[model samples]
Target: MSRVRTLEEIPLRKFHWQMFFYTGGGAFIDGYIIGIIAVALAVLQPQFDMSLTLVGMIAMATYVGMFFGGIIGGYLTDIIGRKTMFLLDLGLFVLASIPQFFVTDPAQLIIWRFILGFAVGADNPISATYMAEFAPSKQRGVLLGGLIALWYVGYGASYLVGYWLLALGDDSWRWMLTSSAIPAIILLFARLKMPESPLWLASKGKVKEANAIIQKIFGKGVILSESFEYKEKTSFMDIFKNGYGKWTLFIALFWTLQVAPAFAIATYIPQVLGEFGFADGNMEYLGSAIMSLFYLVGLLPAIYLVDKIGRRPVLIWPFLVSSVVLVVLGITSSWQMSFALTITLFVIYGIFNTSMNIHQWIYPNELFPTKIRGTAVGFGTGVSRIGASLSTFLFPLILSKYGLEVTMYCCAALFFVGFLISFMMAPETRNMTLAETSTLNKPSIKFSSKPSPKRETV
Candidate 1:
């Protein structure tokens, strides 16, 4: 058997691409559903006669559901299995989306949006964990980064769908919201055919099943004996007990920093545009389309650079540049200057934000041991959603009370804070095996009970 200790030794093969498509498709659906809501709000506002604050509340409600869903999904993924959680999330998305087409009241729309958000949140932690586990160590960055890029494609598609539906008239909003269900349904069938995670199976004491799946993907006669080991059944506290407490805290903070400014900027894009003399009607829609296009364009380079440049540099540099852009955007009040600054900041935001997005999903899975990977990822992501939920309310209020320039400056400052936190907390996991990556930050734990036989030393 080969004794490979570093990520550089893992060979690339066809199986990784197969896993990428399945996981990426799941992320794509998430982006589609979430993006559709943003566009739908634009279409629905005139019909409902709602204020911007109320609209922001509708978006916030979704994140509130997502916050709970992420926690539940993470724990369930570890206990039940990756494939099962993945398939179930798709099912929830389909159920929630169908009723949205028929909703007449703002309350009904908010309720359905929250339900859909819960499903999207559940899918995120599971998909990120499953994709990282299946990928070879050397290619984890690219494979995972590509999955993020696919999500932008999903986001862009929503904008295009909204544009076409708007051209068709008011009835089109129903079509745009309900149309998201089709992709969820397609992903449901595709997920059913995909294999369970071999690593997850092995962690669960189902060694024989794990080996069978691994061999199927890696081909017959591939040795698995070295990889198989008895593992203790893990609980939520295992995250803190097994040298992971500090890392977990850091990751949670990292996610909060990312989510705060990102949601703040995104939730108020149309309002910000309108403040600068852009009309509140189709002009807002056109501006959003432009921003979405810029976001999609930014994702391409992130896919190419994530593995080559390392996670820390890619994630950090963008926030620093974005901080500058946000400040500049805040200072400019003229319509022409605002347009130039908005486009520039968003393009920068898209590039940097997409880079950070790649790491947020990929890093937590790699940072924790296989025993507690899902739990850590779920909790970290859940915390981030809470930050996003708060930003939904906070940004608009900040803009209302303090005005646009102060709000933009606050967002810029938040990016700097995120940069500092990440610099101190996040370790570089580039080109490292999951096992090696987990060891980068050691934790101090006090075990209440004696170690079980299943808890083998690394």
Candidate 2:
């Protein structure tokens, strides 16, 4: 009896872009909400008489919400289905942002951001798995990389928007925080038409429905080989016992370390630049926008290289280079370089840090089966947010007390640990079908000597 063709065997088409833009919409909003806060905090903290610690807490709040949202959403997507979480999460995000425009105090802003963060957190795995499952294996890296690249674009966009919105005067922070709702609103309508992932359908044994979707995608009737079969049930423990648990762990741990430095530094870009004479609300937002632009630029080359060089090499080398960049940026900044030179140095730093970060963002969903992809990705992402939150919470105080040089050096050292993890431990799965990489085709630990001779699949 013939089954449906596996999702990877299907050709790419306009439907994929629909999925790309639909899912990317939420990601764009998440990045915007996360990015605009740097300037928003700069605007609001002094207006409200917030201490440095309160500033950190306010900054840390959204990440804290995202941490749990990822963990919960990850599990729910697997149990419920991808489409449900896709719409519901973005709705929650929109609902959370509505109150931000009305907030009068620090605690109110923090609470709203946390709720918004949870909704943003929930979108991560749902979008990652949705795109990975639907993408053709050969171009999977570019597609997933594209999904992540737009996030940086969103980050850059937020700063750009915040810069102009400063015309709202002190109230720009209100507009900046609330503006994330716009994209989330658009995604809800666009995403409603999206079908369940064919892989997710097949996982539930809805073979006819799964085949129907693939037919729409491939524009012809297709057969599902036995390779498409996936048990309806999944467990968190399964990720650990299966070879995939290691991929889960690497994705989580590396993301945690990578994020510790990225978000912590990005949060205070305005403050950091102020030392170089880029003060005032408008100029601060402009400098912050420029800082974010390099991250977006860094993602450009990855669109070409991630599929060509393979994930491990692309992931490893950029991380190593970014680590060096961080250390040198630290050393240079300590000496008080010319203002023009200082901004240029940080711009270079943004390129490498963002390139490596995009690679890290795409890893987890690509390495697991649909049955557990959401959970595994969520588990890793949730843990990483905690690390990110801690850094956000602590970075302000650390920088204030110890100076910029110490913080920069410490961030560089953390990224070096990320390099070690990617270089020494991360597996090469580029160009392989998810089943082949996840080893669902053969039930054995991949790290064991002589992993059951490689088995190719549709």
Candidate 3:
């Protein structure tokens, strides 16, 4: 007789890779949509004769929409199911994206951008949860890490596309804004054939249905993980109970610290590079595109290190190094160093800063249980955007008023604070099953396939 394997123990298979591609596809759209706006804002400012405040409003609009989307979409994913929200958001992505090409005013553009941001926000939690629930424990880090990796790839592609589109005359920003729909449509159709998360099904006490999916997708030999047998009603409030609140706080803060500076900087990278004398009409966009490449390159090492050295170290060290790099970059800018030297410093900062991208998708899903995983991830996503939105809105204004040195110094301080927090709060989830990581305080717990009414302590 053959040994039976749990879903968490299954070896690498084609279907697993397919899932990775499909889920990570949403991440690509998220990155492209977010990054392309940086380029669009440059054109929009000159075209519309917009004030600085209005420019900031247009830049920060998506993040504002994300704030609400993260909270609502996450709760809905937990209540309704992952696959439902997963598809719905992509549909929204397609519908909301097309209108940008036709917008005659900032208000129209902001409304559509907000809807697009909402879709990205909703997809963030759902995609992470779906990937986590199915991935084998040994490959989980790399798999989740790949999702973030794809995000950078998409981010980089946006700049490349934006740079290329600059040649299409003054109306190129319209095309750049509308370009995201292509991938969103592709991913939407690709995901249609994918099934619901079996772990989610098992959590809802649909064992037969869950098993059928497992057998169909992963072969008849694989079984659902025993932990999912403990069916419990998931409530948004559950994220705050059973010692999970600390994790909720930590994940939210860490994500915020990472993205606030990163997003703000990336959103205005062209302008920032211009400050250092790279200000030629399209030269800054080209520089921004190259810097985006370093962001993708940075993720390559982290994909391996995340599983090898443990999540805690991977989370903690990058914050320290990136903080120092930003400070150096600030001083270099103050000294009016050669453009090459400044660019080298910016590249270094970009690489080290990107190490945290992996954790953005990894930590939220790993830290919470199936019952409220979406809600927890969504809460983190929503909260993080608040900081990202504010910083992105303020970045250009600050850069104009305080100069590049102060902006870099302020960002460095934020990075240093992140280092301290992660050093204190980051957990090591290496080689641990979802069951182990979710209930960090109760490592010895197990579950039977039999139904239960009591709430699981995750």
Q: How many residue pairs clash in each candidate?
A: 0, 6, 0
lDDT of 3 at 306: 92
- For model 3, residues 265-382, the per-residue Cα lDDT tens digits are 9999998988888787677888888889887777888888998877888888889888899888788775667766777787888888887779988988887889899999899999
Q: In angstroms, how far off is 387's CA in candidate 2?
A: 0.7
Q: Estimate every model's Cα lDDT from 0 to 1.
A: 0.76, 0.79, 0.87
Residue 40 lDDT in candidate 3: 91
Name the better of 1 and 2 by lDDT.
2
lDDT tens digits, residue span 99-179, model 2: 898998999998998898888788888888888888877777788888778788898998888888877987888998888
Model 1 RMSD in Å is: 5.0
Tens digits of lDDT, candidate 1, 1-458: 43322112346767667778888887888778767777777668889999867887888888888787788888899889899999898889899888988998889988988888888778877888888887766678888878878887887788778877887788787888898889989888987878887778878888789878866767544433343345658798877765688888888887887777877666556667777667655676677678877786666777667777778887777767778877777887453655666666667766777667777777888888776788888888788889888888788788889888888888888789888888887777776667667766654522221111121232
TM-scores vs. true structure, each candidate: 0.91, 0.93, 0.95
Best TM-score among the predictions, by candidate number: 3
Q: Can you list the residue pairs that collide in candidate 1?
A: none
